[model samples]
Target: MFYFSICFMFFIILFLMSFFLFILSIIFLMMDMVYFFEWELVSLNSSSIVMTFLFDWISLLFMSFVLLISSVVIYYSKEYMSEDFNINRFIMLVLMFVFSMMLLIISPNLISILLGWDGLGLVSYCLVIYFQNVKSYNAGMLTALSNRIGDIALLLAIAWMLNYGSWNYIFYLEISKNHMEMMIIGGLVMLAAMTKSAQIPFSAWLPAAMAAPTPVSALVHSSTLVTAGVYLLIRFNFLLVDSILGKILLLISGLTMFMAGLGANYEFDLKKIIALSTLSQLGLMMSILSMGFLKLALFHLLTHALFKALLFMCAGSIIHNMKNNQDIRLMGNLVTQMPLTSSCFNLANLALCGMPFLAGFYSKDLILEIVMLSYMNLFSFFLYFFSTGLTVCYSFRLIYYTLSGNYMGSSFHLMSDESWVMLSGKFVLLFMSIIGGSLLSWMIFPISTMICLPFYLKMLTLMVCIVGGVMGYTISLVSLMYFNKTLNLYKMSFFLGLMWFMPLISTVGILNPFLFLGNFVFKSFDQGWSEYFGGQVLYKNLKFNSLMMQMFQFNNLKIYLMSLVLWLIILISLLMI
Candidate 1:
């Protein structure tokens, strides 16, 4: 009961704070006003401890977006979770999640960031497991363990910073530029960011995290948990660009982008499709951030937040109307029933595919053009464009499955766009999805970027997107008659569909060997050799010795003779010594 009121309180406070922060962010942008707060905690000997908060245009703008999205997400969750008995607890968890994100958003010190970092991981685990199912439990563990790696990395970075006698990483960009310790710290931070953002070798948890409620998915995937890594890297971009770690991140992020898009095409779950799309966009942000486009990365990050949130909210609406059925195979002609949601979904999908003048287009198109103009190797160039096509491929494939077919859901389903609370949450982001990109592009870049490329090169994005759309339409046209042929190619399809077995490689693939080793150790040491030779062996020897002594004390002739002989032998041995 109180949770609902508190949620409303948070929504109002965050919305108001977001408004003022955006204005202040613009002021900081225009007037170059950077504010830092350092509170002295204590003085010990010659050193002092302080709590630091940094307020600059970058942190402020990010905070504004985080708060704004969180407000809408909380609003959306009201209708979505209303039926659940644990709705109050859900609201509380969501509030904690939002608070942790704000803490992470404004901190310049690694020590303070770790508090928020660990909070995000812990709160997200709670939210992921809120369903009280085995699947949710496993997903929660995976999410927690995967994020723990980044938390440890941040801890190491903080420990490593001790050499410099300060935790304020903002102040060391120039001093630690070329130092060896800084290189190690940079690598650790990159590893942290990669794990948090679900980059290659650590991406299995993102889609699996779809076990969470749809509203949590919208919040976590869009603007909170997944983006934390990208934001961390954005803060450390100066150390990443042109470094070895940056080059590696560029390649890995490109691969992650490709893999996510490919996996989404083969996915059947509606929510997971969106999850993979989020992963792909995260890869985009990370790739460009590695390429030294921090502003472009932030621009896309903000714009992506708007549409992706809207996308997931629409997804939540459809999922609810379908009676919690998330399989797209059961969802068709949804556009005819839930017109508003379908429209929002289609708009978000188009924005994701980088439709011209939409949110994704402004950032995605610019990123592609910049990649085209940058002198890069052929491999990186192919990855950039091909991944873009894959994004559209999945987007169109999803569109065809969900919106274009005859009604395939249950006949009893009362599918409609009647949830005003949910719709209200969506419309704000929907408006932003259309207008936020252009506005951000204007505000983020006071001076527009200048680029010139050949016409064919400039049109490459449209060309690939067209090809992908056609492919998607054709792929979705595969009727039941063609199901047998896919089985023939099941091996290849399974590999591609399952993220190239990275999930296997990340999950059971990693745990099995360690589990086997642990079993072996338990058997041989705790129950086998050590069991036989340890305490039992010592007790057995002592018992046998005591029994032999008892035998000698028996007062029989043979026993006395044996004891006398043994005693004579011992005395002679002592005399010789």
Candidate 2:
């Protein structure tokens, strides 16, 4: 326990240092100076592979938030994971994850970025499977492999960068602007980002990754793994700006946001609902980024990290008190039993729903406003607004099921906010959920946004929030009366509940075909034909020759004499010819 406390304190100190650095970075940004440091690692044929770090307000600010949240998570885990024998290992894995994220944040060179990218995937896989359960194992594999696709795409991008002299893509962005090679690199980078960010087809892994420990989920879904993709695109936005691929990315991200928002409404698991929300927010970031709003995306990313992490921590507290029951269906009247947690949970949910003055409002509402102002096709326009409404829809639904309904759990359970460590973390984040967005907006975007729109367009987001919230609450009330009645929308519910069957498509439709092909190859080519022809036939021939030699041993001299005479006769015939 003392050792864990020491580790927690160490992280807290690191986070403080990062916060100071972030302030310094802002000062530097204002002064028009950005820091760049590089060390040459290898040079071949005029192309140099260098490790490079870039320090600007964006990277520093993001790093500060990541460290801050990570510190809180570690502190929270000291209590959350106290009973687990391997708590130290879990903490260390999280620390490594943080370090990897920092590496990724600072790296300007694509070659060096791979170090952090691969490290994230590797460490996240370890964290996801920390419980050593079958579910965790499967989730870890899905998460790892899904992210691996992005890793490969990044590697391909790096390979393509070899066409230029240096792997330092930052230096080359302007020089190679709109070049075919650069476009290819941009396309590959977007694909990589998609995999990491859980956009569309790769989105299945995010919800499934809820099998990880709740703390890990909080870190991963909030600030670290899923956000890596958005950050990557943000870094590469110079090249992606106004590119055809960027428009395509916009469409896909919009769809992903809508998909995840709908999925959350049907999800039952507490953590999964939050996970899907993270996915939805990720889509928002990606879509906004695709519109070339890099700073806006970064702003939302930071704020989302704050409230989402807080939400997860609150969820963790509830799950702990509930003895690991995650189904919101079985959770009710938590407000009466665990007032503090319930309050924090409701606050975070409101933040998630983009309530007027909360953290989410500063970013999410602004994002919606920006989307409405942008020139977009009908499909994208509809997706953006509908997805925004769905955020409110699922959030209110979640609030009703968990906080306001009748007590649905066993009466023997005792719930309270006695854990100081956990409460401390939640309180810190709760304060942030209220003010983090407003604070960050002031710090990151000093100039306020200027929008020229009609009154209805301005009130569009507020109206959607109201309608969605009312519908969600009314549906939750209706659910109780019809609790035992068969839901006619079971098919639709099942589809949305299962993330539009993406997990099924990824695991069954996508993976099963390859699995079947592998089995067929192994059976027909490897075990059947290859085995019989190569190994079996060779063995049979060798055995036959050996047996024949054994039969004609020294004891069988007549056979040896006959073979010699036959050879001699063939030699004489050749000589005469």
Candidate 3:
């Protein structure tokens, strides 16, 4: 009861704070007001260390959304973590995560951003390993180390920024595009963002992080861990949009989107599928931002946060009711038992597919339309539309597996919709998922986006969604006959299902050489040359000298008399000379 009260208190406080922040953000947006507060900690010759806070609409709105999601996730945790012995610890970790996210959101200074960035990496590692199993430990290490790459990148960026004599990166955005040092700083920042966002090469950690508890999954996937990179890039768009690095980011992020979408279609794990979808969306945000649609990327980022958080919460409810089994193949016709959760789940799934006027439609459709309008290569165009179709295919496949067919799990488990506390936590996000897009569209950019395109081009998004849905439903209906037919394609399926061997490359393939080299170093240096020359050999020399000295110390009058005669002869020879 005491722990429950603490959870409730946090939820209430965050809810109130978010509410206030939202209102303030709206006012700030309407008035075009940006307030900057600076506290100088040190003022040295030609260098000042200061803590700076930027209260523009972007930071305020983002902070509000993050706090809102964190509060709800905390509320949901009360029910989900009710049986855990250390619920308070979980709450504290979550609170720490929120604080770090807020810090990242508000800072315009590179040094301060690194502070928050490091905070995020540290706290998320704690959350990932909260379960304390081998899988969790591996996942936590992967997540931490992957983010550490970005942390190092940010550190390098900060160090590079020192050449500018101040760490406030905002003042240098326009200047960054022209200078070589500024360009390097931008690249470093982009590298950090890519790692944090789990873009290619670093993609292994996002799904592996599913080893964490569902509540942490909700928080991490939604607003904190993965999005941190996108948010940072959003801040650094000025430096990237006009540079070659921007084009490279677009290509990489587009590939990431396509890879994630294809992998999700092949995935069986429920949490992993959702995590992949988040990855794909992140790619969309990055790709779009690289194409110079900053507002669209930010729009998608905010909307994605709402729906993804809701989706994870719904997944948690289902997982809890189904005895924590996350295999989608083992779940079917869950709507019959868990109506509310199923409704929210289905809502999120459709939103992800960009169906009609749901939260995702406004932003996702606009993004696709803008991509169509952009002058880009056919390869990039194919990646955009094909990835969209793949998203719907996987979403529908998930729906058919979990919500359409007869119940597939054991008959003994009683999946119920009685997790009211969890449901209550979900309601805010559910409502937001329905209207958050339009609401943000109205609030952020009052001036509407204008588009003039051919009818066929305009309808491409809907066409892809429809076809993808059909493919999803059709292919998911696998009978024994279907199984036999696909048996010949086992190798292909395995390749696609393995995320094109990305996880293998990231883990075993990348680490094997380093590990082998470490072993060689251990043998050749620490244990071989080092052990002999500086260790064993030196010890043997010291021991031999000590033994010789001890022998001289023994009672031996003959040896002492010989030594005295030699010394006296030396003295007489010196006097005669």
Candidate 4:
């Protein structure tokens, strides 16, 4: 126990160190931005590799959110992680994940960005499997493999770009601006980005990933992994602006938005529902960014990091209090008991549902504004239209399931609200949910008014908000009524889960046939070996004859020796060649 305490303390110390490093990185980013904005290329040597400037307006905004979300997640994990569940390993992986995400955000070069990208995915896999249990291990493995497929595409893009002596992000930016290589490497990279972001047909692993602990889910879905895809898109937005493939990306993002949003509406698992919700929101952000509404997408990303992390952690707390019962149906009237958690989750839900004056409202409204202005694109129209309704449905469902149902849990003891360490983090996010938008709305939506939105536009947004809320409320009432009498609506809403399984279905033949053939071949070989060696007859004879047994044993030794000699010869020849 004392040794475990020492290990745990070591993790705490590491977490603090990471926190300090993050602060320092943010300061450096500010300095980097100033240099990038004002400095000329002629002023510096070409080959120098010192602390370099990487900031653009997008990177600067992304860095701020990355730092802020990572800090909050670390703080929340300090108390939420179970001491017995390899807490030290969890903290180390968390710190590594944060550091990698920071590197990704400010990465000046594609090579550097890929480094961070691959590293973040790898560390997240570790976090997912921190429990060292079978289910977690399998989930982590699957998630890692899927992300690795995306990683390979990124590597291919880097290789293609480097073939032209372009190793930096500026190559792609220049290509976008100049219309160079519009269809090849650019398209490949976009597909890679989609896979990483959990876009349609590739989103199955994300829900499965909820087998991880809630903190890990929060980290994965909130800012690090899912956002990596969106960041890649934004980073290459210049190249994507007028490209045909880029237009297709807009369509794909829109489809993913509706599919994942609706998928979340009927999930009973707390973490899976949130995971799908994150994917859906990411799709919205991606769709906006794909249409060149960069700042609006980023603003949504920032607000999302704040509230989504809060939701996941509070869900973690609720799960902890229930001794890991993650079924939302089993959790009821928990808000009155877990006030701190309830407050944070409710605040996040408000933001998610785009309720009035919440951070989600301002950020999400910005995206809607962009979509409205560009309503000429039929894809955009359907994307935003379906997304608005689906977002409200799932957002309300997530809130209603966990805290609004009649109490149905077994006799469960309630601990105090959450630990001070955890509550401190939750309060920060809750505060952000309430005030972060209005305070930074101008900075967040730089294309709009710096201080306040135009009067007419604000009024337009207010009308949308009020109408959307009423529609959401009505849908929830109808859902409740239907659920009380039947389960059709619930089952219909969840049909998208079938789409999520497409990948596994496509690969089933490849895997199943080979496995079946291998099993048959191996069984055949075993029977052939046994029969030819007369193993059963030999065993019966050996039981009655000692001489026969000695002869058979000698023959076995001779066969083994010959096999070893043959293997050595083959190995030697291979080595020589």
What is candidate 3's CA lDDT for residue 247?
95
Which candidate achieves the best TM-score against the true structure? 3
lDDT (CA) per prediction: 0.90, 0.88, 0.90, 0.72
TM-score for each predicted model, relative to the true structure: 0.89, 0.91, 0.92, 0.78
RMSD of 2: 3.6
Candidate 3 per-residue lDDT over residues 1-577, each given as its tens digit = 9999999999999999999999999999889899989998899997867789989988888898899999999999999999999998899999988998899899998878888899999998998899899999988888887888898988888888889878888888886578999889989999999999999978999999999899999889988888999999888888777689889999999999999999998889999999999999999999998887788898999999999999999999988988889999889988888888999999998998997888999999999988888888999999999999999999999999998788878878877888789999998999999999889888877888789999999998999999999998889887322778877888888998888898888778876777789899999999999989897999999999999888779868987888799999999999999
User: Could you tell me which residue pairs clash in candidate 1?
Assistant: none
Give lDDT tens digits, candidate 2, residues 220-332: 98889899999999988987678898889998999899999998888889999899899889999999999999989999999999999999999999999989999898898
Could you tell me which residue pairs clash in candidate 4? 176-239
Among residues 3 or more apart in sequence or in different chains, the pairs in candidate 2 whose N, CA or C atoms overlap within 3 Å are none
Better of 1 and 2 by TM-score: 2
The C-alpha stretches of model 4 lying farther than 4 A from their native spots are 1-53, 175-182, 415-418, 444-484, 488-494, 497-500, 503-577
TM-score of 2: 0.91
* Models, CA RMSD each: 5.3, 3.6, 3.5, 9.8
**What TM-score would candidate 4 get against the native?**
0.78
lDDT of 3: 0.90
